[model samples]
Target: MDVQEKCRSWTADHLRDSGDCYYQAVTRTSGGTEVEFRGTWVIMAASHDYLGLSADPRVREAAVAAVRRFGTSLGGSRAACGSLDLHEELEGRLARFLGHEAAAVLPSGFQANLMLAPLLADGSYVFSDSSNHASLNEVIRLGDAKERTFLHGDLTHLEELLASVGEDSGKLILTDGIFSVDGDLCNLPDMMKLADSCGAHVVVDSSHDLGVLGPNGAGASDHFGLRPLLVTSALSKSLASVGGVIAGPADIIYYLRFHARTSLFTAAASPANVAAALAALDILQSEPERRVRVLDLAEQLHNGLRALGYDTGSSVTPIVPVLIRGRERCLRMWRELCRAGVFTTPMTYPAVRAGREVLRVTLTAAHTDEQLMRVLDAFEAVGRNEAEHPR
Candidate 1:
């Protein structure tokens, strides 16, 4: 069948099922841990707002002020007149925050990853994690560099790949600091050792790790007290804003600013987003407790689920995946949780492997202990019913 036929088949199957839980229209939100879906208030457990500052008064005010002063978009790419003082300021602060010499702001995290292609010299060897984010894979493909994949977190496999490459060829090791699907952290310390031995430059896509990892929330690289050659991330997650950043050495950032086609071609991030990102960064630095609380909440939820006989894969980060055996079962569980007033994400085929289906549960700093208990209780009730019915 053609692509359209395949699409129609999937839609028909999903639309006919009571378990279809995709594309929930969130009509309202408390801007924190609760959201109103179809006029019902549900505890949000699928959000990426790790710091829970997306709706913070400070961030909102900063965004509103920017809209008033700048009146929405800059109307062009950064290469033109789109560059704003807010963008420059945010980049400066982010560079210091990430322990980088300099940083470049992009319209999105996807675009930040796109900067990779422009940096790759010819004959570059890209060693990527099998489970790296799609954006990283896209960047490598765009660069048209020779690519090698290693099993996720399998340093021995990576070592073999690195050893096979000639010493003279440029080597780039690309991996996500936190695997978005399974919520497992990359073996950064061991990976770095391998890279160092092979004289390969490491690039960490830290979209899920920034503002959620490290001693100062600088990400996994910071947590390990190691500096990769470059780091890229989205501000939309923990920073609680919209935009992306590429942080690295000043000279390299300068090169990407002028050479990276993605940044130069796409419209610059809106003034409000940049302003809100700045405000969020301030909050992130001042309130380190958000990081602590969010991780604690994640651990609580993970342990709570495991205690109830659910398999939460190896995740110490805010993103937790509750492993389920089948796609239909995962969707049914998600629907049950939604009915119980706890909103979560269901990951099935295409998003995850067939047997690796899961209910992707995430937590934010704003989530309370009471809310967490409600979530666990909801899961417990759902699991009990499923056991009795065997659906």
Candidate 2:
């Protein structure tokens, strides 16, 4: 067979055993924090709805209003007639929220990285974290810059690499502010210090931390009290929308606006997504309690998992991973959790390690304390039962 067919054939047996659940769809949410999956109410632990603003009535109304006014498509790219008033407003609001001089809203956070990295990569040596998101890695490879990847969150190693490079023209350090899989926060302040010492630029992809970090949800930079060279985030997560933002100096945004091919070629975000993002920002600002609740519940979940002898490696955020190691055991636990009316996703091989597979669970503000307890109970019961079989 062809390459596509060959790949499919290679993984068909493995996928058939446990990967099918990923394709299953939820008809609707049974509760704000639970979904109706396969005719059962499964508590949601696999989504990025940290603040639960995606289902907020105000966010929904804002989206509806935009749709009513703008229809659907916005014609051409931002460089063309696709540039709308909503886009500019959203960009400005995001900049102010992040305490940045300016911002450029993109179609998606992925596209933002794909475009921005190339612009900054010219005449530069790149220092990237090994565990950063795929988008950052893609942009680095696409660019002409020479790149070095240090161990995840290893600033000493990063500094060593930077020191060896000896001040390149466009020295850039790329990292995810909040790692998606493990939910570990990168030390941006220390990274900034290293960048400063080495005369390098820092890029913080805070896609997973925006609208859920900082004292006021300003983002990871604000949380660390340091202003990096560049900050980027996806609106889809806590922003409850479907776009991305690149916040930094206005001059940089101006440069990217003119040079970033992705922005120049791709159309602007839909009016509904823009409006929803704006609404989500408002909700995030007005309701700081949501962030508190999410973190609290996450801590509780983390603790419970640990007490049950599940190895959750270095996570302090809402995303909790129960490192189950073996693929078979991981799939078995996932299946058991699903059967027990708990919805979760398993992270394996490419996402993590083959021998360090995990059941990745994310908590949101929408999850009630009672629901959290029930989820823990499910794990407790399932673990107890699975121990006897050990399959």
Candidate 3:
């Protein structure tokens, strides 16, 4: 079938059956731990707000103050007139926090990843992790470079791909610190060694790990005591704000700021978002306990679910993937969870391979032990029902 016809048919069938799992409107939120999802108050496990600072008073105040001072937007791209003091300030703080010489902020994480496309000069080679986020994949597709994809976290496969390429070719290895769908970490220590052996630069998309990993929330690279050639991340995650950052050496950041069409053409991030991110950064640093608390909670949940006979699939991070195997089965599980007063996300085709669907449940520092117990109870109830029905 043609694209339009296929879309029409799929939308009608999918929405009719499982659309509530896709976009249930959240009318209100309390920190990032709970939300009024579709008029029902539920414990939130579907958010990327790992630090639970989105509803923090300080972050809210910072954003509100910026709006009052800057009047919503600067109204142009940073290449022109949209640049603000807040943008430069946030960039500087991010670079210092990430142990980089410099950083550049973008409107979103997708655009931040796209910023790498312009850096792929002729004869450049890119070795990418197969499970990297779609934005990273798109960057490879947009650039005029030879591409080699290695199986997720498979160092041997990565080594083979790197060996096949000419040593002198300008090479950049792209990977996600935490695979979004699978919730497994990249083998950065081994991968970095491989890249160094081949004289290839490495770039890590640490969108999901920043502020939730490492000694000081600098992300996976920091956790491994190594730094990539560059690190790209979304402030929308652990930072509890809206924007993206690319952190690296001063020269490379300067080059991307000037030449990256994605950043040059798009409007700069709003002052409010920049301010909110700055506030979040402060919280991430000052309140390191949030990281510890959230991680502890994640481990608790992961173990609980496993003990209950769920397939969690190699996850070692706050982002947990409960493999449900079938699309309709996954949707039904999501619906059942919601009914039990727990909010979660369901993943199906395109997000994951067909029939290997899952529930993408995330944990935040604000989540309480009682709430966690409730989540496990909900899962147990749902699992019991599934066993009885045998779907």
Candidate 4:
């Protein structure tokens, strides 16, 4: 078949079988409180700006200064010409922030995983959590490494899998420090203990945990007092900037800097992103109360949803999913919430499994108690209406 015909056929089949798999874009203002699409303002509850620093004035100032000094792009890969003083500074600050011996910054978190997976190489087996973020799964596929998946957050299953793998094999146990969809934390201390017993290295993707978990926002490892062999995180979520970082032993950082193809091919993070992340790190280090406030808000929001008769499913982080049973019902709820001035995303099918559609709500530190109460009120109203109408 011709390329156009093949593309058309695939599209037709996909639309016929999965017509409900679509997303709507709602333009957001700089403040992040107001979202406008098709000329209507809506309150945003779907963002990953956990610390609410995306539009913070200090962060903006840092970005602006960096842009003036360095322009917009890094222009080349780190191996070539992209490395800058800001890059080294950010890496150093992040390493210190996470209590790691060294850290390396990449263009994105996806690349960090893509690089690390293959760097571990042929004899290694990857033990990944079933509920890990898609990027890690993609890394496992691209690396062409032997992999086993344990049940989501089931430490017993993880231990069993680790026990089955031989001790001589280099095993890398990979999991999200905080599972993105459910906002539930991994049982890190237990997982670390199991890995230690089995002689496996632990790699945690703390994209959702950094700037939100642990004392002083050191992340899940610190929260549980169990250090992993390595930690990877995205700056986009909590740090409210762009770029990714991998933190571990100095040797691992050195190896990835030289051998990881993704790092070798892609341009390093831009100066502005580097600067903004550095500023965010400074804020996180000096004022740890921000982390406490964000966690407190998350707890309050989760409790509020539960009190209103929503099934939030064991979430202990900033992300809370309200189970809505059917795809249509979930979308309807999302639309209703949006119209009622609270914007959230409807997650269904591949993002989750079939029969587990939900309205995913992410809480941020910027949201006030009044705003949270308003969100709860909207959910309560929708819940009552949906119950009465049975749709």
Q: Per-candidate TM vs. native?
A: 0.96, 0.96, 0.97, 0.94
lDDT (Cα) of model 2: 0.86
lDDT of 4 by residue, 323-347 (tens): 9998778877877787677888788
List ranges where model 3 is wrong by over 4 Å: 1-6
How much is the lDDT of residue 66 in candidate 4?
98
Give the worst 10-residue stretch by lDDT in candidate 4. Answer: 17-26
Q: What TM-score should be assigned to candidate 4? A: 0.94
lDDT of each: 0.90, 0.86, 0.91, 0.85
Order of candidate numbers by lDDT, starting with the best: 3, 1, 2, 4
Candidate closer to the true structure by TM-score (higher is better), 2 or 3: 3
lDDT string for model 2 (288-360, tens) is 9999998899899999989987778899998898888788788788889989978899877777867978999
Against the correct fold, how does model 3 do in TM-score? Answer: 0.97
Q: Compared with the true structure, what per-residue lDDT tens digits does model 1 show for residues 203-284?
A: 9999999999999999999989999999999999998888899999999999988888998789999999999999999999
Top-TM-score candidate index? 3
- Model 4: lDDT of residue 86: 94
Model 2: residues with Cα > 4 Å off, grouped in runs:
120-122
